[model samples]
Target: MSKEKESVLEGFKAFLMRGNVIDLAVAVVIGAAFTNVVTSVVKGVINPVVGAFGTQDLNMYSSCLKAPCETNDAGEVVKGIPIMWGTVLSAVLTFLITAAVVYFLMVLPMAKYLARRARQQAAKEEVQEVMEVSELEVLKEIRDALVAQRGSGRNDPGRNGPGQSTP
Candidate 1:
């Protein structure tokens, strides 16, 4: 393969291997599955609760925009403008519920965890920097002490050099 094609393939491989990309793919799959659950809840639980005051089926609720709104025997509107507000309301409720659950259960916790991890990483870096600086300072102090001792020893007549004996 050409170098350009090889590099592009390598880049694509790296992108696929990234954790966030995998996470996003998983989320999409799970979201699709969760949609069925959310729909069931809205249809079974929410609709029944609303049905206490009116019809059990949310799809049945509607408002007449025109003067003579009517539906045929097959439940299809044959004349006038029939605004199906209940269907819209049901959709809105489902969206809100899904959003609330995802935010509270997934997004919020992940955000907090990432924040904590970042703080911990920053603290660890700061400690490493401090340790490096302190180690350097200690090494410098030791060198200075050794130099001072060597200078003092050389000036003193009592201590001899490496090969010289005291006369």
Candidate 2:
């Protein structure tokens, strides 16, 4: 009934508020923005450099099975089924560039940073352990000293109390 509906809405609210969901949402938004930059670089810089050596646009390069691909204002098919190999090549190149940038700029650095943090945490733990061991050693020494005093009768309140002199 209405109780089930309320539970479902509460579950949905919890899902939306989860840290992973929020992180994923942020990452998608940032990725979209980054995609635009990468696309611009591919179109503006990389494409032009590649075009200098070959065709003006890589996307324009294609293969026609019918022999003639480009036609001059004819109502008929210009060429065979044009397989746009150039566009595919362009897409592949863009993918490679994006992967390389993300790896080097984000993933690799994040991995290095995480490793460094882990090392630091390990070192801090070691220091704490050493300090704890030293403290334990001091505590044992104090305990042993008190035991020795008691055995020697110096710790006895009646025999060698702080205010009374031993006869």
Highest TM-score scorer: 2
Mind giving the per-residue lDDT tens digits that candidate 1 earns over 19-94? 9999999989999999999999998899999999999888888888896887789878888898889899999999
Per lDDT, the best of the predicted structures is 1
lDDT of 2: 0.87
- Each prediction's TM-score versus the true structure: 0.78, 0.82
Off by over 4 Å in 2: 70-78, 154-167
* Clashes within 3 Å, all models in order: 0, 0
Give the Å shift of residue 90 in candidate 1.
Answer: 0.7
Provide the lowest-lDDT 10-residue window in model 2: 70-79
lDDT of 2 by residue, 1-167 (tens): 69999999999999998999999999999999988988899999988998899876888787788777666575445556777899998899889989999999999999999999999999999999999999999999999999898787865656765556866
